[model samples]
Target: MNALQFIETSIEDGIGYIFLNRPKQLNALNRKMVREIVTSMEAFDLDPQVKVILLTGNGKAFSAGADIDEMANDNPINLELTNQFADWDRISLVKKPVIGAVKSFVFGGGFELALSCDFLIAASDTQFSFPEVTLGVMPGAGGTQRLTKLVGKMKALEWILSAERINAKTALQYGFINKIVAPELLMEESVDFARKIAKQPPLAVRLIKESVNKAVDLSLYEGMQFERKNFYILFASEDQKEGMKAFIEKRKPKFTGG
Candidate 1:
């Protein structure tokens, strides 16, 4: 594949990495950058070697937000013609987990992009906000929905309406960010987390991810049924047999994603 202009892609230890590469522009989510992100993620989804995907910024800020200069003059018709949001939707369709390791100024679309991940690990200095309201707009991405689902309407509205910068600790308190580490240790900790999950049985990992994401939208009964079905389905997998047999033999299980 040709070298990407807006992002960098790499694979290591069963983890696929997407680094938002526009550092000087604060890694803003522009059309080209978003396309690269979607394309890389789709590629990783198809690659058997990639068990997990990690998304983070390449520089000082994860992202300042989307490219305002590119969108400032847009109207409904132009937006409709582009169908710009379809690219964002592609992130959710990915079968493998995508972890967001973010820091610094994660605002507006950056905050929304982070939410698109399966989970997040942030640096202690990270600050998140949905400042689209300040521009007489609102979060066109998942911010309003995911954030509200995360911390409830009260906190979501408070932050969105005020455009308040919610610090890392507060975000942790709200239960959006999975963990926060020292700025210098951010990448190390996040990669370690990804590697840990990558070591799990790949079939189980994929099913578990599918079950959990379904929990967000499905009713409790439907979600439980979905989970139960998956639980039963795993018994038919070779990894499940290996896992139990290894436990009985007091030996480590080796899973081949079968």
Candidate 2:
């Protein structure tokens, strides 16, 4: 826990929960919190029992971005800050799928954090924005790249330049959120989704995530070649055989993560 000062972690039913615990600060991302998040994610990746990870907040806001107090007088644009942003890029590359259970405000760094996840479940009232421009800065996190990929260049540019807040429904329309649930059902729905995914073969899930992520940056032909390589690798796994056999036998496949 020393790695993060404003977050709490818990694991159960093959899901790892990472909670932003700084309610007083609206779950702001400070230096300590970011370090803690990265450390916790590393632990989750190594834990055999954890099949999925959930990122959420403890109170009203999911996260309001960075702690303005810390950056108030310092040089905000520099290599050090850029490295801090790359930490999130690392999070997005974790093999296990991550789900963002977002509610209330998810702005700037918070928005970037949600974007890092493989999927997002947002509350009906949740608000998202890239208000960094209003602060006389830009989203230094993976926002610049990830948001463009998710919502397309035009919409991403409009949102970033306008620094306007969009409602959950609008986010869904723009393909920014995977699903929208009522506030009270956000956690339950997200956990339910995680459970369904966890029941699938773990090795297949890992390979699929890796293949898709790697393919996005490659040419269509190169991406298909990468997919074929992963497909063949998966075909050689015992889990793949078991999966097919179980389906033919109308039985549940007990994956061993092999």
Question: Which has the greatest TM-score?
Answer: 1
Assess the local accuracy of residue 38 in candidate 2 as a C-alpha lDDT between 0 and 100. 77
Cα-lDDT of candidate 2: 0.88
Clashes of each: 0, 2
lDDT of 2 at 177: 88
Evaluate residue 252 in candidate 2 and report its C-alpha lDDT on the 0 to 100 scale.
86
Root-mean-square deviation of Cα positions for candidate 2 versus the true structure, in angstroms = 1.7
Error of 2 at 218 (Å): 1.0
Q: Model 2, poorest ten-residue lDDT window?
A: 76-85
lDDT of each: 0.94, 0.88
Per-residue lDDT value at 183 in model 1: 97
TM-score of each: 0.98, 0.95
In model 2, what are the clashing residue pairs, if there are any?
Answer: 3-36, 4-36
Error of 1 at 81 (Å): 1.6
lDDT of 2 at 139: 89
